[model samples]
Each structure stands twice: as structure tokens, then as C-alpha cells.
Target: MARCVLQRLLLLVITMTLPMMTMAGEVSVAVASNFTAPMKVIAQAFERDTGHKAILSFGATGQFYAQIKNGAPFTVLLAADDETPARLEREGVAVLGTRFTYATGKVVLWSKKADLVDAKGEILKTGKFDKLALANPKLAPYGAAAIQVLEKMNLTKQLGPKLVEASNIGQTFQFVSSGNAALGFVALSQVFENGKLKEGSGWVVPSNLYSPIKQDAVLLTSGKANGAAQALLQYLRSDKAKAIIVSFGYDL
Candidate 1:
């Protein structure tokens, strides 16, 4: 019994230390799903130059806000919109004067095969397929854009019922990728991250179709002018990172 108790305590100590060890010289990032591809590229570059690691989590802006409110220990947040980051600062949870728009996102209707979408954007109304996927508009900005485009076309009432909802933009893209849904409304970046539409055919939603997706980033209260956080932010604005961003189909 005594030996077993000792071993158990030793295991507990090891488990607790593991996280601390991984976190040493590392920054915690709560990145919105829309920006994952470029963020990953920038994080890799930052790690190479500074000898520090970035632990990143990608999700909807609303979810990350909730987690930060609950003290999730994220040092930085790259949000799909500016409002949430501003709200966090107002709530005294994020660092004031450290928030700014990072990138502008584009939306697209994508499918695994070509010619799936028509010029009229009436694919949803036609109801010619098993499913049409989009992120939950309440949780994701791109989802909201999809709704806006539908409403502007006066097709919301007609096409609303045919929508299949995903929890985030990434999952919405996956629904189309896995053939769980016929096609999806997703950030153009996710579909373009792998270097153009090699397999899938996509409709690049016109700039006039919906509101511009001006994504923003902020330093959290958990971050200061620390070497890691500052470096990461600076690295994000570098020319190298910007090149990667454009390569992923996002407008600068």
C-alpha cells in the first residue's frame, strides 16, 4: 500500500510538470478558425527565429471569448471580427490599446467538384443536393456573411430551411470536403491554404456580395510586452507572413 501511494504521487507530479515544461518560452494563442492557415505559417516562422513555441487553438470567435472570460490562459487572440476584441478590452479582460485589425477575409462557395454552383447563387434554392453547409451564423462571422448574401438576394426565406450548420468555418469546410454535405460556404483561405483549388471548384463570392470580413487581433491581459507575445504580433505583420496570407487566398 505504501509503495503504491508513493508511485501515485510521483505520477501526479510528473503530469503536472509536463504542461509547465511545454509552456516554457511559449505563447498561448486563441486564434479564430478563419485565420488558422496563415497563423500556422507565421507561428512556424516565429518559432524558427525566436526559439519559442506557440500553442494555438482554432475556433469560433464567440467560443474563444467565452473561454477567455472563464480564464482560459490565452496570451493572444486573433478574432474574425473587431467587435469581440474591443469588447474584451472594454470588459477589462484584454489589454487596452493593443487591438488592431490584422487581415481582411474573403468568402467562397466551394465543392469537391467543379461547376457545382450556378451564376445566380440559386443552388440552395434549387435544393438539388443532399446538403448545403455553412457555419452557425451566431458563432462565426463568415456564417453571418453567408446569411447577409442570402438576405440581400431575398432568398433567405426560400433557402433557409436547406442549410446544414457546422459549429465553425473549418467544420463547415470539412462538411463539404467529407461529402457529408454537397457544398459549403467557407472562408476562401481554408480552401486556398493548400495552394489554389487543385481539387475543388469554388465560387469566389464577389466583394460586393457581403460585408468585408475585417479580422482583428489583440493582446490578452495574460500577455504583456513579453518577448514571446510582442514577437508573435510583430511577426504576423512581417512581409513574409503577408506573402503567406495572400497565398492562402485572403486579401491584404
Candidate 2:
């Protein structure tokens, strides 16, 4: 009788505890490389607060656009530029009326070594370094912006031979960070901490130097029926997420 009573008590405890466990769902997101660090922080908080998980894949927005078109199984896209998401919406690959600007990013002329980049970005004209890094202009919005800045200063031809091009902004940052290149153009969010550049010297490029980088996010047709996808999209616009984005040097 005692053994049977103990077994019944254990079963009752297990049954009562099961109802309190939340059934979490996953949402796959294609995130722009510039947004990677902030997205990691946001994903953790989202799962903690809502019991929903976000699976993130980070890369250049242009590459992501091609991947999505080729039938990559991504439910949400956090693009580095507004145009790509808009194009996807126009192409009918993304859900209509689901696109929104999530953040605005700035490009910066950055050097991992302190004092290498002057406040006015005079280092470019001086050409003190053997190699200057930048992303591939054809694939990254930041890279295009860097090109515009170079053009505005008439440094394109002068710096062309000395340039080291990476496929994406993240790789451009790596070039500078790893000391392979003396300096590079990277997203402000990459080198900033607590509203300032972390350990390096950088010049925050003027917005007038290039087109506005209005980063946007959209839900793909694949996510149309996914509750977790919709919820994650909504959560991105929440006050908490906004606070995190701003802290990472992105604009609302």
C-alpha cells in the first residue's frame, strides 16, 4: 500500500508541473550583419520574456535578398537598408503591409588603433596606411555609403589601389580589428559602446555624405501562418528592444 501511494504522489506532482511549462516556438530570422550583436541581445530577452525562441542568420542584406528569393527558409528579414525589404514586398515574397523601419544606422571611418583616424577623417587624404578596408559596394549599403563619402572627397581614384574590399560590413570590421587593414568603414553600431566608440578612433560620417541608411524589417510569406514570427516582429518594436538598439548606437 505504501509503495503504491508513493508512486501515485510522484505522478500527481509530475502532472501538476507539466501545465506550468510553456511550449516555446522558434522563429527563423535573417539579420543584417550590422544588426548581429544587438539582435543576439534582443533574442535572448525575447525568449526570456515571451517563451519564444528566435533563430538568427547574419549576413549582408543583399546576399540575404538573393537567398530569400532562391527559397531560403527564413521567416523574418532584418535588412540593413529599407530598399531591399521594400523590393521584397514588391516582389510579393514578403507579406504586404508588414514592412517597417526598425533602425537607422550610420557609417563610420574607423581604426582599431587609437589616434590612427583623426576626428575629421584626414587619414584618408593623408594615405598613411598601406591598405584601407571597406565592404563590397555592390553588396553592402554601408559600402555604398563609403563610396559616396570617398567620391564627395574626391578620394576614390587616389585610394582605389590601396583598398581592401570585404564581402560585407562585418568582414570589413574584421579587417581593421584583426590588423590586416589599417582602417575601415564599418557601421557605427559595430565600434560603439555606451554612445561612444569603444577603443578605437572613428569619424562618424555625416549623413549628407550618403543616402540615409534606414534599416527595415519585414515578415516573409513563409511566416504568414507563424504565430511566433508575428510576435517576434511586434516585440522588435517594443520599448525594450528600442532601448537596446539605441544603446548599440543605432537610431530609432
Candidate 3:
């Protein structure tokens, strides 16, 4: 009986230590739709350094708020604006003191073709198209910027009815990329990659058009005890990570 017991104990010890010795379990994240491109850069770098994978769910801040409220299994959140993480902390959904701004987002009016827009920002006067797409302001920060730009130019009265609403920035870009809408408001980073434009042409919306998009991050209380979760938060703020973020049309 003693011999059998000794063998069983050895087997259990190896089973427990084997995973810890060689692998990092993936961390799950709920990232704001607008931050998708930059997050990809951040994730790739993090994985190379730590051997841990980030499983990301991209969507609107409002929808993420709803999911976390209903007990979604997410370890971290990178929001499109500061309000969501602030609210999550207030509601006891995220770890207090773990929330901070990660990036500032920018919005742009983009077209699949250069001729479709004018540098003077007079695409509206061109009159070659009818539909304009933007994220739903209620759900997305960039969407709200699109509305502000229209209001600033006093074109909201004429363009309001022609607006096509996307549930999130990803969908907003998709609408234009697929030609479902002639032009759309999307994150400046969407058409850009590694500090260069990847597809199409765009007019960067003026900063005066809307409030700054202060994106935030937090460690969900559900994953408070996780070493990997904290590691991810730290990784995102590292100098190397910041370089990639800046490349994606965001400011640290």
C-alpha cells in the first residue's frame, strides 16, 4: 500500500507542475471595437514576450457594459472611452485603482476612393453619393464625433437623415469597406496600419469637432487574482507597446 501511494503522489506532482513549467494560460479580454487594430499589435508583442495569448472580444463599449453586467467571463477591458471603465469600477465590476487611460482615439471620414473626398472637406458638396455611415453615437465614441462634425459644419440638418448607423466602429468601417455606404466615420486607425494608411483615402476629422476619446483599461475583479491579468495590464503600458500604439494612429 505504501509503494502504491508513493507512485500516485509523484504522478499528481508532475501533472500540476508540468503546465506551470511550460505554458501560460490565455487571458480573456473584452476590448472596445475602436481599439481593435492597436490591440492586435499589443497582443502580438505580449505573446512573444510571455508566451501567453490574449483572447479578445471586440464590440461597442455599451454592449461590453451590458455583458459585464450580466456576468460575462472576461478578465480585462480596454474601452473606447474613460466612462465605461469608470462606471465598471463604481459598480464593483472592476478592480479599483487598476483602471487607467491607455490611448486617445481619433475619428475620420473615409472613402474607398481619393476622388470621392476633397481635402477642403467638401465631399458633401461633391454630390456623387447619398449614404453616409457612422457608428451609433449611443454605442460608439467615433459615431458621436461624426455627429459633432456635422453639427459644427451646420450640415447635420441636411445629412442627418442620410446617416447609416453601425452598432460599433468595426461595423462602421465594414459598411464603407464593403461599399454598403459611400462614405463613413471610423477610427483613424482603421485605414492605417503601423503608422501608414493601409487602404482607401480619408479626411481626418478636426480635433475641434468633438471631445477627446480617452480610452481606458481595467482588470476585471473576476480576474483580480490572476498573475496573467496584471501582466497584461503592465505589458500594455510598456514603452515597446506604446510604440505600436502610436503607430496605429493613437496617442499614449
Candidate 4:
């Protein structure tokens, strides 16, 4: 009887765990560079709750768009701007009605030095820095926003010569953090955590300076049959993911 009980317990355990093992899957996601930190946290939570894994690739949204157009195998896209996903949807590469704004981003003028950037961003007028880094405006929305900020302040012409362009917001942050550029316009999430700046000094660019950065997420055509991909998209809309996004200083 004890032997039969042991066999029954083993069978019950297998029955309970087999479905989770079979349902667990991996989704490949192309994510914007600015969303990296928060996405990592959310992905972890998603895996824990749903038994699915997220495989993430981070880069400039424009580059990801090009890759998707070329038939990249990405299952989903988390873009820095709403335009790219809408374009994909129009082109029939992404599923219609699957795109939505996940986060609204803010840009900041930041420096590794503790006191280089003033609260009101007077440093842009001061012109004390030799190299000011920003992502390539042609490739990154954050870069375009930075340009708008400079133009609104009427300092673009004066600062143009000192500008150093990076391929993405992540690289832009590296340029400033490495001291190659004294200061740069970067996503606020890069330098903020848990309601405070992680390091250095920064000026939160006023919203009036540029268009809103409405970051969006979408399910790609390649993901339509992917259970993990669908789960991840739904997970992104959950309160858990939104809290993580907010913790990283992004607006919902």
C-alpha cells in the first residue's frame, strides 16, 4: 500500500507540473534603448507570473523598424515613438489594434558631475561644456526632442559645433557617463530610479520644449501564433508592469 501511495504521489506531482512546463515559452522582443531598464524588471516579473520568457533586444526604434521591414524574427516591438508601430500596422507587418502607448518618456540634460546642470537648464545658455552628446536626431525620437529643446531656447546654432551624436539613447548616456561629453540630453529613466536621480546632476526639460514622447508597444505579425508573445503584450498592460515603468521615472 505504501508503494502504491508513493506511485500515486509521483503521478500527481507530474500532472500538476507538466502543463506549466509545456506552456512556458520564449518571445523575442525588440525594445527601444530608453526602455531597457524597466523592461528588464517587468520581463522578470512576467516570467515569474506567467511561466513565459522574454528575449529582449534593445536599440534605436528606427533601426528596429528597418530590421522588421527586412523580415527580422522579432515577435514583438516596444518602440520609443508611436509612429513606428503605427507605420508597421499600416504596412501589415504588425497586427491591427494590438498597438498601444506603454509609457510616456521625459528627456533631461544631464552630467556625471554633481553640479554641472542647473535646475532650470541655464547651462545650455552658459556654453561652458566642450562636448554635448545627443542621440542622432534622424534615428532616435529622444534626439529629435533634444533638438526641439535647443531650438526653443534659441541655442541650437551656438551649440551645434559642440554636439556629438550617438546612435541611441543608451550610447548617449554612455558618452556623458564616460566623460567624453560633459553633458547630454538623455531619457530621464536612464538616470532616475525610485523617485530620485541615480547619480549626477540633471535638468528635466520642460514639456513645452518638445512633442510628447509617447512610447508604444505592438504585436508583430511574426508573433500572432506565439503564446509567449501574446502573454507579454498583455503583461505589459498589467498594473505590475505599469508600476515598474513608473518606478523608472516614465509616465504611464
Best by TM-score: 4
The better candidate by TM-score, 2 or 3, is 2
Model 3, residue pairs in steric clash: none
Return the lDDT, model 2, position 101: 93
**Candidate structures ordered by TM-score, highest first:** 4, 2, 3, 1
Residue 128, model 3: lDDT of 65
User: lDDT scores for all predictions?
Assistant: 0.85, 0.93, 0.87, 0.97
- Candidate 2 worst ten-residue window by lDDT: 16-25
lDDT of each residue in 1-252, candidate 4, tens digit only: 999999999999999999999999999999999999999999999999999999999999999999999999999999999999999999999999999999999999999999999999999999998999999999999999999999999999999999999999999999999999999999999999999999999999989899999999999999999999999999999999999999999999
Query: Candidate 4: deviation at residue 182, Å?
Result: 0.2
Leading candidate by lDDT: 4
Which residue ranges in model 3 land beyond 4 Å of their true spot? 1-23, 125-127
User: Candidate 2 or 3, higher lDDT?
Assistant: 2
By TM-score, the better pick of 2 and 4 is: 4
Q: In candidate 2, what are the lDDT values of residues 81-137, reduced to their tens digit? A: 999999999999999999999999999999989989999999999998989899988
After aligning candidate 1 to the native by TM-score, how far in Å is the CA of 25 from where it should be? 1.9
lDDT of 3 by residue, 1-252 (tens): 999999999999999878865767678999998888778878988888987889989999989999999999999999998998999999999999999998998888888876686666788655467789999899887888888888888888788778899999999999999999999889988887766668777788778888899999999999898777888999998999988888889877
Cα TM-score of candidate 1 = 0.86
